[model samples]
Target: MDLNQIRNDFPTLQEEVNGKRLAYFDSGASALKPRVVMDRLAQFYEKEYSNVHRGVHYLSQVSTLAFEDVRGKVQTFLNAAREDEIIFTAGTTESINLIAYSYVLPYLGKSDAILISEMEHHSNIVPWQLIAKMNGMDIKVVPVLDNGALDMQAFDNLLTPDVKFVSITHVSNTLGTVNPVKEIIEKAHANGSKVLVDGAQAAPHMTVDMQELGCDFYVFSAHKVFGPTGVGVLYGKFEVLDQVKPWQGGGDMIETVSFEGTTFNVLPHRLEAGTPNIAGVIGFGEALDYLAKIDVNWRYQHELNLLDYAMKGLKEFPQVRVLGTVPGKAAVICFVIDGVHAHDVGSLMDMNGVSVRVGHHCTEPLMKRFKVPATARASISFYNNKEDIDQWLSVFPKIFKFFG
Candidate 1:
């Protein structure tokens, strides 16, 4: 891959911050958008803007075709079996909530339970908790090992017959631990439970095939994948998703409306209610096309090299305590300086124009597991290089000097 060309695609990366070159290290929160995606969004708004599936005008038909085509692109991207199985939501959080309310709450009884890991984001945990509270269902947690890997033995123990559904993150947003989701899916299916994989982190870094993984449901946000925010994709196995009732009622999701009776639409439209994020979805398609041009192996190796370089540099600081040391983990490092708060470290980094995330990162449970209140996370994207790492690390000595 041409590294310079790839970096050039992101206009924000070229700009300066506080008189220093911007070194973005917070990709785990949201990826920097490529110029192609930004231009596509502006183009759609200027030329092709219209409400899809409603009007008979020329712009409406053009917009409808463009919107539906994105659905097909997502289907091919995830290797889903059918095009109608893809549903667009606000983001991964909304997708999980849809499943929790529309599928799980109705299907599972009081005696049933759901299994999730301790490393899950609040988005994955809170929805199930809401449903479980209303229905008296149980929520079981799989522990995280000290090395930031899931405890497979505990997971096995937790995967009981009573566990009717399993929700797990493909990659931990905090620890950057890539879980054994395929194996977990196989085990869950063997125990007669359906599984949902939160692919928000995994989708941006690596390729995901729903058929190969054999997951019942998979979800990821567009912003995390270099697309626009306020748009996300939820891929469900057709057989499983067809059984779910619509969670919200509105214009597009309905087949017919009357005072006495109403009927819902089929597959995708049944789930997508009201006017959707038309411009965001179109830009998301452009982002996917942008990624398709690059060789996956090259991108993967590039980020791995960056991760290794950053880790080696962090090792030089005795006061630095890095969390999630799992081998073969993704390109994220969550660490804490012994004598400094994470917020202070992050603020100091910002003065040097090096952006990083500092906090629980929506995984308070994982933070407590590591015995820290918060951490500074440097999540690497393929766009990043050794120079970004060097600039990020340069702030640590300033942090020490200021704190001491």
Candidate 2:
């Protein structure tokens, strides 16, 4: 897949950190932006900077066209049925919250329950807890097995008629376990429940088709997928999203406003309030364009190869215990070394110019379930190669020596 060319696209990889070459293994938190995306952002701000959707002036019109064109790009990215079904928000957290407040809270009754998993990020879990508490609704959790895969039998048992909605992560940020979201969506639909899939981890690694998955809602952050931060997507089915009320009231989200009353705009804009992230959205379109040039299957297989190589290396160290050993998981390794704190391991790795994420990763519940206070995670991307994994693994000996 032209690995050298791919690495060259990210200028950060060329830089040195602490006199060592940077082995960036933190793609799950946020991916390194490509040169094209950054250049596009600069171009937009320099020449076409203006507030979208109002002015008839040339810059505003240009800005508006460029910004809205991204919505179409996202629609194509997810293979959604309609462009209007895609809503822009701050990030995945905001997207989930918007659904909780705008759709689920208004439609579902107090007695209805929402189902989630132990592996969900805090973004997926907390919003439901907040709304459920306020509305006197119940939240059900599906258990994770010892191997970090979901207990599908338990999921089936929990899919009772009382569950009005289900929210699950497509790929776990901590465990790297790819949940069977398509199957889960089908089951939930059969049982008369809608579903939302958090694709923050999955979208960067794989392709997600809306018509194929048939999820009521799907969300992912642009930064995690080689785009800019402060912008993300919420893909909802048109029939379902059209029925939900607007979560916020402000400038562009309205059809009309008077002292008497105010009416809202159509599908996508109805949900996006105020001045949207114009530059970020335009850059995100460039990111999608960048991704389209690559083959999806090749990317997936390359990441799996990286995962296997890293796992094999980690297995050689008796002190290292890797979490989430399920087959076909994403290219993320969350491991804890014996007798060393995760933060210490992270610091040591950083000194070696091998970046990794350490802590609960906003999945405190998953950490508690796994009986670990925290873990050090190295998440991979298509741009990473065996040399990066070698650098990551080379730090283990130093870690063990320091702890001993």
Candidate 3:
């Protein structure tokens, strides 16, 4: 990958923050959009902008084609069996909520249980919690090891015929631990339970094939993959989606509606109710195209290399404590300096022109489990280089002294 060329594509990186060059290290929260993605969005609004799948006019036809084109791209991106299996939703939270409300609520009963892990983000955990509470079902949490990796042995012990569904994150946003999703899915399937892998953190770095992974459902946010916010992808096997009912009701997802009754559309359309984010979806496709051009393995290697470098630097600092030291993890390195609050660390880093994410990272449960208020997260991306790592490392001592 051309690091200089990739960095050049993000115009914001050129600007100075607090009299220093911007060093963005929060790719886990959301990645920086390349010029290609931004330009694609702008071109759509400037040239072909109209409501999709409803009109026969020129712009409408163009917009509809562009929208469906994204489905094809996303289908290829995840290597789904068919384009109809991909459902466009708001984000990972909404996608999981849709599954909970539409599918799980109907299938799960008093004797059923939904299993999740302790390292899951709130997006993956809360929806199931609400669904389990509303229905007569129960929620089970698979324990995490001291190293923050999922306890696969404990998971095996927890699995039973009563487990109706399993929801797990591919890569932890907080701990940076990459779960063994393929093995998890196989075990869940053996017990006749469906599996949903939250790929919000994994999709951006790794190549995900839904067919190969064999998970019943997979979800991720577009913004995290260099696309716009408020857009996401949900991939479910056709047979599974056929069994599940629609979560929302309205415009496009219908075949017939009358005073007495209404019938829904097919696999994907049945789930995508109401008007969609037409422009955002097109931009998402462009982002995927951009990603396709770059070597994914190289990108993964680059990000992981940065993580290792950053981890080594953090280890040399006496006051800093690393969160997790799993063998194979994502580029997310979350830590807390002794005597300094995560918020203060974030603020000081920002002032020093090093952007990093701080706080519980929407994982308050995990924070409470670890007995820390929050941790400052330095997440890397493909575009980042050693200079960005040096920028953050150089400024940490000052932050430690300020809080000390």
Candidate 4:
């Protein structure tokens, strides 16, 4: 990918912040939207703004086609089996919640357990907690090593026959460690468990295929992948989704309603209730289309080169300890400056027009394991370059001196 040409696509990258050009290192939080996505959203609202599936009006027909087309786009994006295997929700949190309640809750019992890892975000962890609380099912945790990789030995030991489901984060949002998901899925399947991968981080950085991974279910959020917020995806096998009941009941999700009883809709629509995010879904399609134009591996290598620069530069300062150094790791780098609050570091970086994330990064258990309360993170993205990394790295000396 041409980094210079691609960089020009983002309007936010041109803005000045605090007397300096903006160096956005916070793509892990949410990616900056490109102009094409903005134009698509405006076109939808300006011309074809109407509710979907319920109206026979001309505007509604146009809007419904555009909205449903996104479902196909996502199916192709993830290489899911069929278009109906894709379900839309608010975000990654809701996607996992839908699986927890609809597919998982009903299958759990006192003798059954759900397996997760120490490095999971709150979204992946808390939903299983709710199911465990509701039923008597147990929540088993796979440990993370000192280097921030999942302990495969511990994971192997934890995968007992009682584990009815396994949900794991595909990549550590904080550590950027890419787990061996294919092996994990196979191991879980060997134990008669269905696997759900939290691909919110992996899908954005690298190409993902749900079929080849052999995962029964996979999910990610749109905003993380340069699409609009308020939309996320849940990809389940046809057989798996066939077994799951609807999580919500409302207008479009129902096939028939009576005073006696009500029947739910089919495949994805059953899980997706009420009027969906029409404009946001349309924007998501455009974002995916824009993404398809770029070579994924090229972008990944460029980001990795940026990551190497940051890692080597951080090694120069003895006070700054970077976290999660592993081969085949993604661009996110979490680290801490000794004796300095992460928030202070983040605030100082912001003053230089350098954006970064601070704190436990929604993975408090991982933080507790690492024996730190919080850390400052400079997460790189495809739109970011070495200059952006240098902008943040140059401020580190000032941070250290100020803290001292």
Q: Tens digits of per-residue lDDT for model 1 on 1-404?
A: 88989999999999998999999999999999999999998889999989899789999999999999999999988999999999999999999999999999999989999999999999999999999998889999999999999999999999999999999999999888999999999999999999999999999989899999999999999999999999999999999999988889998999999999999999899999999999899999999999989977788889999999998988889999989999989998999999799999888999999999999999999999889999999999999999999999898888899998
Report RMSD (Å) for each prediction in the order shown. Answer: 0.8, 0.8, 0.9, 0.9
* TM match of model 4 to true structure: 0.99
The alpha-carbon deviation from the true structure for residue 341 of candidate 4, after best TM-score superposition, in angstroms, is: 0.8
TM-scores, one per candidate: 0.99, 0.99, 0.98, 0.99
* Root-mean-square deviation of Cα positions for candidate 3 versus the true structure, in angstroms: 0.9
lDDT of 4 by residue, 1-404 (tens): 67888888999999999989899999998999998999999999999999998779999899999999999999989988899999888989999999898888887888899999999999999988988888889999999887888999999999998998999999999999999999999989988999999999998889899889999999999999999999999899999988988788888888899999998888888888888888999999999999999988888888899998888888788988878877778999898888999999999999999999999999999899988999988888899988888888899889878877
1 against 4, candidate with superior lDDT: 1
lDDT of model 4, residue 270: 86
Candidate 4, lDDT over the whole model: 0.91
* Candidate 1 Cα outliers beyond 4 Å, as residue runs: none
Model 2 TM-score is 0.99
lDDT of each: 0.94, 0.94, 0.91, 0.91
What are the per-residue Cα lDDT tens digits for candidate 3 across 205-314?
Answer: 99998989999999999999999998999899999988878778999999999989998898789998899999999999999999999999999998989888888887
Kindly list the per-residue Cα lDDT of model 2 for residues 1-404, writing each as its tens digit. 79999999999999898889999999999999999999999999999999999899999999999999999999999999999999999999999999999888988778899999999999999999888877888899999998999999999999999999999999999889999999999999999999999999999989899999999999999999999999989999999888878888898899999999998898788998899999999999999999999998999899999999988888789889888989888999999988899999999999999999999999999899989999999999999999999999999998888888
Give the lowest summed-lDDT range of ten residues in model 4: 320-329
Cα deviation of 71 in candidate 3 (Å)?
0.3
Report clash pairs, candidate 3: none
Clashes of each: 0, 0, 0, 0
